[model samples]
Target: MKNIKASMLAISLAFLFIACSGKVQTNKIPNETKYYLPKGVKTSDKVALDSKELQSYSLALEKFFKRNVKADEEKKQDIYQTGIERGYFQ
Candidate 1:
């Protein structure tokens, strides 16, 4: 029947839409590391963080730490902090 064909078409379209509407995971490190070093600087075990890399790494670490601390503060309860505050005598 035409109604059965239409229902099957609708179901197939719905599934196709759902399958295509997914987030694509990318290799973020490849992009981040592309220009991280100076030009002509070959990456190897001998490669070290230049001043720029050092500064960027420091800032990135500081931001990461701050974000984690802010998240902990926003949480209703942090068991580790709670235990440290109540169980430890200092």
Candidate 2:
């Protein structure tokens, strides 16, 4: 009976060790840092702009496009005129 009890305890301890040791540990805190470089961009040439700087840059580009949209349309019209003069199509 003592031998049986010792064998049972050994089996239970083995099972507990296996259960605890085989558990998959997850990351408690996620890393915000990027692991890989973006496609088509070199690591040395890249600049890390802050969110506010990016927002301002985006707004500036939007405003510039809005301001020069008419000029771009005029340039397109000139290109069409030149194409017609060159007899690109009948």
In TM-score terms, which candidate is top?
1
Per-residue lDDT of 1-90 in model 2, one digit per residue for the tens?
999999999999999999989877686665678565578885576768799999999999999777876777776757678889899967
lDDT tens per residue, model 1, 15-49:
99999997687855466545665788875667566
- Write down the lDDT of every candidate, Cα atoms only: 0.81, 0.83
Q: How many clashes (backbone atoms < 3 Å, residues ≥3 apart in a chain or on different chains) does model 2 have?
A: 0
For every model in order, what is the number of clashing pairs? 0, 0
TM-score of each: 0.31, 0.29
Badly placed stretches (over 4 Å) of model 2 are 25-31, 34-90
